[model samples]
Target: MTQLPLLEQAILVLAALTLLASFSMLAQSRLTSAIHSFAWQGVMVAAATALVAAVGHAHHLYLSALLTFSLKGLLIPWMLHRLVRRLNMEREVENIAHPALVVLAGALLVILAYWIALPIERLELASTRNIIAISLAIVLLGLWLMIARRQVVTQVLGFMSMENGLFLAAVASTRGMPLVVELGIAFDVLVAAVLFGVFFFHIHESIESLDTGKLTRLTEEEPA
Candidate 1:
């Protein structure tokens, strides 16, 4: 830590924060709290991107960071908060089978991610190589959360977290992508969120519940 430059060290710290936020989201039971954790993770991603931009002298990354902060950190979260309020799901708790087992599985995934990234980490000539592994772990953990939790909103949170991990991995490994591509991705995420919000309404109206497990149990005799 002492030998590393200030910017590199800051980037590492922010990456760690992002990983911690991923874990927090996975562990959280309430929809509202998990959304908040996702927002904080976005903030960490933006900060890390900005720090990398400073280190690599990539001006476009600054814009990317701003976009990430606005879209993921603020806009999406605000939108989800409104959705929660409208759906009356603010206090809804996710039902996870064997919470401790889930956490242990997540830890094992981190080890697997580290092993998978070993070859790339060795060849990468950047200080952010280790972050790539962390990002992959985050991705897997988010997926695990989606599979283990039995709540619609929590699944959405997991999806968003997985996207975050992908973004982090790209930035760490490639020092950010083209601005046009980033803009497209940002727009796509916003559009997807809107569509998901609309689907939430229809799902709630038809089934009077947001639990996705119920979808599989629907019968022709029962009214949707």
Candidate 2:
């Protein structure tokens, strides 16, 4: 068996850490802790992108890594922290309906992701194929997070995490998207964050709660 290069090994390690971070975010009950986990996941993804850039000699990916670190790693998390404080949800703990069961479901999703990626892996298109599986797992896990969690803020975290997964997949599979595309994505995400912050305030003002379940109840009652 041919040995993987040292940089590729490091990239794989970082990819695994990124997946672990996704799991951490899923299992986290506290809103702040989950956001922190998400930030670290972004950092790991950035590191992996940088390593991929180094391995593939794709200079554009280096810029992608910087953009990811700036937007996903630092700016988004900082914005979320401020939102949590402003919304007075800094100490809020979301109780997962069945924590163990949800974790088991997440594990199943990971396995399924690997299974789905097997054919692509056979092609041996790139050293990052395994990371593609991991990226799919991250995406599935993010979707699962959105389904399992009830808090609007947590759901938003899941949504952003899904974006991270997509970004990682692009880097792993194709070395990175065009600079213009990445910039567009970053801008859209920032606007979404700001809009979500506004939505949180509106929800809080309307019902004094951030639980999404309440939104359903809201529609049932006719406005006065």
Candidate 3:
């Protein structure tokens, strides 16, 4: 048995922390806490990208890390916090229908991710190949977060988190995306955040709530 290099070990630790942050977002009831968890997840992902850059000597990944830390880690979360403040939802607490069941489902998804990544792991394409499983698990957890949470803001958080997982997958599998592509993605994400803010204000003004369930009821009540 051979010991992994220190940098690789640190990357693995960051990967694990990113996965835990995903679970934290899933189980969080308070919207603010969930947002904080998502922010930390971004920070971990940026750190992992930086470590990968160092290990592979991919100078571009360092830029990607800085971009990730700025956009995902700082800008997006700040936008969300501002939106929450404006909406007066700072203290809003969402009730997960079945907390334990949702967490168990998330655990199953992690197992599924590992099973799915087994074939890819065998390829040994990169030193960071094993991180693929964790990346996939984060993606699955993000999807689960969207499905299990009813609040529109929570769904947006889940969506952003899913993007984080995809970004991590790229880092783990391909060592990072082209700089132009990452820039395009960052711009698109910023646009989406602004759009979501506008949408939230519109929805709140029209219906006085951000609950998707209420939106369904509203649609049902409207005359055809």
Candidate 4:
């Protein structure tokens, strides 16, 4: 087997960490552990970005690393923790299905993503192409988490995870996108989170729980 260079090795290690984080997200039933898993994923992403920047001598990637560490790694997860606490819904998270099944489904998604990304090799650097597979898999897993679960809160968390995967894909493929673009995405995600926060209260009041089945009541009317 050919020896991997330091940069490639670093990226691979980070990719593995990301995969683990996704699994952790899938496995976690409660809000606090899920938030922690997401934070760890952000940390790994920042470390990977820093290592890549050092190896490639791309100063912009260093800035990207710092931004990721602050926003996703710290701020957003912290906000999620506080939000859950304020809602008094910390230990009350309800998964629509068993966690073991969810995790198995996520594993299948990773395999599918690898197969799906195989043809995209024509578009990116060799290392980037492989990383893209892992990135897309994470995104898919996030989406699955959103769909498989009933709680709007968990769905929002899944959306955030999806954005994280998108960020990883951008960095892996392009060594980080333009600063303006990155900032735009960050702003958009922040706005989305706030919107979800508002929605959480609304959902709670209307349905008494954020569960999807309960949300169907929003469309039904009590006949007078």
- Where model 1 places Cα greater than 4 Å from the true spot, the runs are 219-224
What's the TM-score of each model vs. the native?
0.94, 0.95, 0.96, 0.91
List the candidate 3 regions with Cα displacement exceeding 4 Å: 219-224
Better of 1 and 4 by TM-score: 1
- Worst lDDT run of 10 residues, candidate 1, spans 215-224
Per-residue lDDT of 47 in model 4 = 87
> What lDDT tens digits, residue by residue, belong to model 1 across residues 55-110?
99999999999999999999999999999999998888877777778788888999
Candidate 3 TM-score to native: 0.96
Query: Model 2: clashing residue pairs?
Result: none
Question: Tens digits of per-residue lDDT for model 4 on 83-192?
Answer: 88888888876754677788888999999999998888766575656888899998998899888888776778788888888888888777888889988888888888
Local error of candidate 4 at residue 213 (angstroms)? 2.2
Q: What is the Å distance of residue 50 in model 1 from its true position?
A: 0.7
Q: Write the per-residue lDDT of candidate 2 for residues 80-164, one digit (tens) a residue.
A: 9999999889999997898999988999999999999899899988887888899999999999999999999889999999999
Please list the C-alpha lDDT of all candidates, in the order they appear: 0.89, 0.92, 0.92, 0.83
Q: In candidate 2, residue 201 scores what lDDT?
A: 94
Q: What lDDT is reached at residue 5 by model 4?
A: 86
Model 3, span 1-224: residue lDDT tens = 87889999999999999999999998999989999999999999999999999999999999999999999999999999999998999999997898999999999999999999999999989878999999999988988988888898999998998889999999978988899999999888889999999999998998888888677674646565
User: Model 4, 171: alpha-carbon shift in Å?
Assistant: 0.9
Q: Which ten residues in a row have the lowest lDDT in candidate 2?
A: 215-224
